[model samples]
Target: MKSEHTETPVTVLGLGRMGSALAGALLAAGHPTTVWNRTPGKADALVARGALRADTVADAVTASDLLVVCVLDHAAVTALLQPVAGQLAGRTLVNLTSGSPEQARETAAWAAGHGIAYLDGGIMTTPEGVGLPTSMILYSGSPEALAAHRGTLAVLGDPIDLGADAGLASLYDAGLLGLMWSVFGGWLHATALVGADGVAAGTFTPVALRWLTTVGGFLDRYAGQIDAGHYPGDDATIDVQLAAVEHLLHAGRERGVDGRLPEFHRELMAKAVAEGNGGDSYARLVDAFRRP
Candidate 1:
């Protein structure tokens, strides 16, 4: 006898890599999965794995109370769901498509108008990372919907409820991606800097990772300073880091490694020093990133 919780019927629309991964995770968790893709043949593998294939978007929407959509864009999502909006009403629409915060908010409005339970999502992993307990799947909009479907959604990844703002998931997604690229640029620059001295990246990376843990602690401490709008210089000040950036730039130049990434850091620190905020903690530079 299948318990009500164990037999969640989920309809996944769009068989793109991420969408397929979502359906596969659900199926592996013993959910009754129905999948549909415009190409039709895209669902072949999932169907073979015992997923039911819906021939049309309408059929897919009607097949399950929980609907997950991952497609090309918000525009593509609109094109596919608008015609079947009637069928979508009263069901949970978990949209994992990539788009701007505004787009997510617009979709949430449209869903609300139709009485559809909406959750705008940001998948914090590649398709390969799907179903991993550590991978985060951010959700915002409709707290009740998240509470109801959190279990079924956990099959995809760790479901992180981000309150009831539909736009927050997308907002955080863009910011987080920006943070990732910054870290990548810094790491790559450091790797090249050391590699210039005949040091292998593999040898340096493990040590670099440990440094990141210390940096993470810095971030945790700085977050409070930023929120309080009072960046205390009791810890290391921006002026101190500015001197360290000079050393990094000198080292990069001597080794013929590009100094652009560290140069940006130097520029920010120098600006703070010139503005007489150099005595403040490194987080004082957060003001440089904000509007006047």
Candidate 2:
């Protein structure tokens, strides 16, 4: 039988940077937390802050109806919890480990097989962002389980219920990271280009930040068009964009700036155009990713 929560006591597994932040947030929110880390010494700070240090994984999971696991990966989480599967029969397992969508779905199935209600999560914020309303944590899994611990989960961050599809959180996490890398890649290239003219990154930081903020609105507008498969060149066509990219490539080469970054953009734009999308919006290039 599953254990019933009478006082909202919570269990935290893994005491890494993110895990410690989560446990600290819970303690600050006045929830009695039971903590267990593979390395016994890692729980010292939480122990000093009134969290009960569990001697074993079983004991930790047994201590609370809501068990939060934030390990390194799916394999580590599986190994750590395999020994305590029996104890998790009725417990709600919220996994905040970063992994692929397939891993999340497989773990969800394993949890269901053990009669555990599972929720997969992706923390979009850093450790310092925990407990703040702005800290967005995407979650997907059993609705009932989420509803049961919504209050407790909110103590860590904003609990966004994506859906019953356990893989959604991880999918969103991967997609967000791809977007982040794209932005970062552009920034690094821009900084390098300006640095060639003896301009420090600090001097160009505000300009880059302002431009990124303004361009962010394109994501929302393009999302609709991308989903609908409508590649209308309402704002800018791929051909026009490709022309601009060519000028960038030429300028980077002339200025002796590393042309690798701009070359990549030029190649992508050229490929999209060659694929008969020259008249379409730049957003239409996203389809190329699905070609495989």
In TM-score terms, which candidate is top?
A: 1
State the weakest 10-residue window (summed lDDT) of model 1.
1-10
lDDT of 2 by residue, 175-255 (tens): 999988988988998888888888999999999999987788887889899999998988899899889988878778877
lDDT of model number 1: 0.94
User: Scored by CA lDDT, what does every candidate get?
Assistant: 0.94, 0.91
User: Taking the tens digit of each residue's C-alpha lDDT, what string does model 1 give over 131-180?
Assistant: 99999999999999999989889989999889999999999999999999
Error of 1 at 70 (Å): 0.5
| Stretches of model 1 off by over 4 angstroms after superposition | 1-5
Clashes of each: 0, 0
Best by lDDT: 1
